[model samples]
Target: MQGPHPVAPPLVALTKRAMGGMRSVGGRLACLFGIVAALGACAVGPDFTRPEAPVPGSWQNAGDPRVSTQAAADSRWWKAFEDTSLDRLVELAYHQNLPLQVAGLRIVEARAQLGIASGMQYPQMQVAFGNANAVGLSENIAKIGGLPRNYFGYQVGLDAAWELDFWGKYKRGVQAEAAEMLATIADYYSAIVSLSAEIARTYVMIRTFEVLIDQANENVALQEKALEIAESRFRNGATSELDPTQAATLLESTRATIPRRQTALQQARNALSTLLGQSPDTIEPLLVGPKAIPKAPVTVAIDVPAAILRRRPDIRSAELYAAAQCARIGVAKADLYPSFSLAGTIGLDASTRGTASANLFSSGSMFYLAGPRINWAFLNYGRITNAVRVQDARFQQLLVGYRNTVLKAAQEVDDALVGFLNAQAAAAFEQNAVTSAQRSVELAISGYREGAVDYQRVLDAQRSLLQQQNDLTESSSSIATSLIALYKALGGGWELRQNDPVVPERTQNEMKERTDWDDMLGPSRPQEPKKNAAPAKH
Candidate 1:
């Protein structure tokens, strides 16, 4: 068969000369190495460039005094609430959340995959093999020659085949895996962002329920006093028995809400426990600080909208995934060209007749074969082309997905800003309502005591007070939670990882015990964002 290239004749002569002497083999290998080095310099396929995503130059709520366009002063945004308990919970969840640990493990897995891709730059196949077998010749075949009927054959050798990265297939593969590993790291930070916000939100819920229950209990006490007045008035013939009966009904109704609020509080605690990766029973002990809803600061530094591209891990992950897919297109395209490889085997072989033994290690018994090879799947209909198209399609999908992620991130920030601002406004009105309701209750109670008004007025005032108070509490909680949401949307909490490892040391130790992870599980920090780059334009 004809060789794949015009230079095959000279290369064939070189191979033959290599086989003639050991010194010549070394010189030929150096020549071959130089040839491969020169050819391997270029990589095939499209080089990755960050895709442009449109985002607003400024936040929609930038005009609001509470929203600042200055760069965020603190990435530990949970601390903005000035609640020590919330800060502790966030730290705990960062180290203990199961899902976050899984994300870190994925980084380790990606790193190993990268190592596999890198290894392909060298020999793709290598093996040391040995075998022994007894051979028996057929009588009919043996009769035609002066040969023994049976013999023993043995061989031991090292075999290796390295398909060089002449087409940049393996290089592209390494680039893809390297990008994937970075994406996984971003995923880990994304998990941290979620875990921190969830912990703060759940903690706020628990406090909200606590305050709501307190309000209900206070209303119950006020109603109990009103009932006493109604009962006395009825016994003294100053009012009808119907008044006391109505009073009793209102008291029981107010009392019923306490247990329900307690249930919600416990449920919130259970959710927080899960976020911390602890049993529900253990969560109560961690709830030791002041049982008050966290309060947001007067002003929050949200920075410009374009910063989201750099700050949000999901955005980074999406972009990196697209980049990785882009590299895959090159990998598939390389299959269209012929693959070049070098294969060789070196071994000792010997055969022994029935009563005789052979020395397999003798220099004369050793043999080796070495040559360059070429492979072309020229007959594959459209498989390789379609594969390239498939990767390109996926790359396009990820690009679109990345753009969508940016839009959604901007939406979240805008939504949270509106929610936070409006909830604060509503809370002001609710507070006023609570104050008016409290004054009305006092006036009604005084009037009923003096027989200047009906017991119904007192009941109405008390009901209004309870409802207004609960509404105020809910609105306050909303303010804090909305702030948490805004911080989350801004992707602030991931900066906590600057001082922490992606995986907890305890988890790393446990994983090491289960498998030989080598340096993959070691302390590794999230990569810092590139500086001074032009922000993505909206």
Candidate 2:
């Protein structure tokens, strides 16, 4: 869009610049016509083909035999937790995380770099120049030759040149840059996947801390009541002084745990706030009271391990880097061959005597020239050959790196699967333990009140109950966090970025104020944004 108030250049200068510009442009067009007639050569390089995703037909730990191959991956896996707060938190992180935004900006940078490389495929030079001259006559020379010794001269013409792509050197450069751009896009998705997992993990930790804190407070209350009973009995001369001391000791021990739990809770909250791109107070309102930790869905689905090779962003990025390196190999190899190009000039020049004006557009003033050029690096053959070898070596390294990334992605998913499955089992056992301990605490306390058990027995039971409850909370949180890691390894969540602007509105606005992006920051059009699938129900 044009600025609200536009400024116009002076008409005379505008006309002059336009006229001068066309002189070179017209020459370039004529040269391009001849080049186009001969430009039917193939791009010299190995075309890119995506490597097969080396993955197992089925996950070793898929757990269920009934899982259908047709099951769709969860695009919104966190929503399976059925926790509205977590849903909101993930969405907020997507919008606000600065590091993820920086990743998006890297895509923009790569895109501009690609444009620079692509432009090299076109003519490299075109210029128009004008010159004027005057000379004073020597009367002695004029008398001898009967020639005018005073004269005025003027010249104006185009200069143009284009390096032909017969060996596809420039084409290979464009290919390399295009692949690099894809790699950056993949990295952007990888960043979002990592950010989402971090946010969920931190939030779960906060909730876990909250649960532990509540458990400690409850135990402290129980111990305090026990101490009261012991004090009442001692005052009535019915119990020993040692009994109240033991009760007081138990109460203080439980109370001491509160401060540590509170500290962890605050720190976890702070971490979560940072992930949300906000101040520490940002989560305070959402956590006004204790809330249960998010629970994993009952049924988990996983794609065959091979599916992850296509789904994971890190793997995709590694593969694209390899492709880019492969293209560079061709670009380097092309340096060994002689280069071809075309050069030309066309426009007007005129001379006038006395005070008469020159007619620059007259047929007598017109002139033209055009030709082909070649360059060889025959003396630098060793350098060019070694450069080709270097590119090939780099391409091999990236290819290996891509394979390693695939292996690592599968390993991560396998590890997460084991961790999540075990966490669920452990949480189940802890739930049972909590239940039994709760009953034991009640029985021990009742027995003591009726003088059937000692205060020591009541203390043991209460302590065990508190420990069991805390363990259960940790197990539950683990299940949730492990699920998040699994999804991350599976490369979910980034698909949401499709149809969304790569640059945030605020950042785009700031860029516009500081510099002209010149269509770089415009809406991503032409290319269909990439979408990734999610892991199946567990």
Candidate 3:
């Protein structure tokens, strides 16, 4: 550009002085922040130690060849069925399920809470503000001879204030928040595990209902044939009207089951659709064709009972919640100590006597200040101690809850294992009964056709075969569904979400459009979980 603009000597001197003042203050503030941060490293109160896990060495129901001490290999337990459709459904549910999405949102909320707690360790008051005002003193206003009647003033300043963590109150608060965030993550895993199991169970029920419907229709056809034969025999005076009436009754009874099973199938579809986070009709295309009931693998790994402490998301979540509560005890204890703070303000202020004028950077207007403040709640010890006791009590309750959760998880696994094993046995026996009944029905129908036996025998054999087949189908479905329940109890499928984004893309976009979050919604770095101490090996 052209020659440098000439500087007024007074303004130049003021600028140099102001720069020096700013340099001096900035240097002190930087050193102060560093010192405070270093001193803050010494946190008061009890440090956390993970509680020991209470569980058995082996599962009570793991005697079967299908169940063993080895842990499950596939975290995607649903994939063990080798069902393409089921795999797709689980994938869709992971992405689209609203409850799961809500769980993810909770994780985001917990992360924000942690951020807020961490921020408390830093300056609580930070702002740069400027104010301009005009003042006119009335004749009645208190005044002195040296004071001007009217004046204009302007102030530009930045102030910062920090409540120091002298007793580690803020650090303990941050610890609690971090634990809560981890608990939220565990809750998210729990949601996924439950959601996947539900989807598989519902699908199995639908398929079982479809099979039942087909069997009922087949029974209806057999009954119709018997009715036709009885009517022919009665018309030819070879049988009584009672025979035809009985046949008709049986055929109508079999037909009634069709509508019931169809209704059930539709309801199952609706439930599965809900799990996929869509309307009932949306799942029709996926479920329209005939599909076999999903079957479980012959052998399933049960893992050691203590593994529940790690594998079960509910158990993990409960323990993490207890840990968070444990930290609250420290937070409350920190309150018993004195509080410390540092407050400061650096500013440029100016005033004029005539129409309008300001000399903001002038030495006479520049100002800076800093000081320490202390507050001790010496008289509130009763309230503080009671509050701390309350937190400790809550932490103990959570510990008990965590233990209870472990027991429940073990019970569920036992129940599922026994149910699945017995169901498979029942299915096998029912299949044998079905085979024998089928042969009897064939013989009786042939004997009646040849006039070697009465139609009552035919009817009995047909009814027995139909019932046996239905029972077998039901048992088969139970085995698959029970296995799903067992997998859920084992806490499978949550690991699939590792490294996945917590918030859905659509929700993130909507949130961004709604407000300025200052990138608060960004993904958080994954934290290594605190492990519970295991029992000593014998």
Question: Would you estimate the TM-scores of all the predictions?
Answer: 0.90, 0.82, 0.88
Q: Model 3: residues >4 Å from true position, as ranges?
A: 1-39, 288-290, 353-358, 450-452, 515-524, 527-538
Tens-digit lDDT track of model 3 for 14-124: 656765866866686677667866787677666655566567677666777767666564687888888888888889998999999899889888877877887887889
- Model 2: colliding residue pairs: 299-538, 300-537, 300-538, 301-536, 301-537, 301-538
Q: Cα deviation in Å at residue 235, candidate 3?
A: 2.0
Q: Which one wins on TM-score?
A: 1
What's the C-alpha lDDT at position 313 in model 3?
A: 86
Superpose all Cα atoms of candidate 3 onto the true structure and report the RMSD in Å to 1 decimal: 5.1
* Model 1 residue 201 CA deviation in Å: 0.5
lDDT, each prediction: 0.84, 0.77, 0.81
As a whole number from 0 to 100, the lDDT of residue 121 in candidate 1 is 89
Off by over 4 Å in 2: 1-40, 65-70, 130-155, 234-241, 287-290, 347-369, 449-452, 513-538
Can you write out model 2's per-residue Cα lDDT over 109-225, one digit (the tens) per residue?
Answer: 988888788788888898877898886767655353444567778887778898888777787787788778777888988998899889888878888888788888888887888
- lDDT string for model 1 (1-538, tens) is 3455343343344444446665666577778767976898677888877887889988777999877786664688888888888878887888788998888888788878888987988998888778999998786663534557888898876689998888788888887888888888888889888888899999999999998988898899899999999999999999999999999999999999999999998899889988889899998778888778998987888868878888999999998888788889989999999888889986668888635577766555566877788899989899999999999999999989999999999999999999999999999999999999999999999999999999999989999999999999999999999999998999987866755666678877888888877677754534422211112223
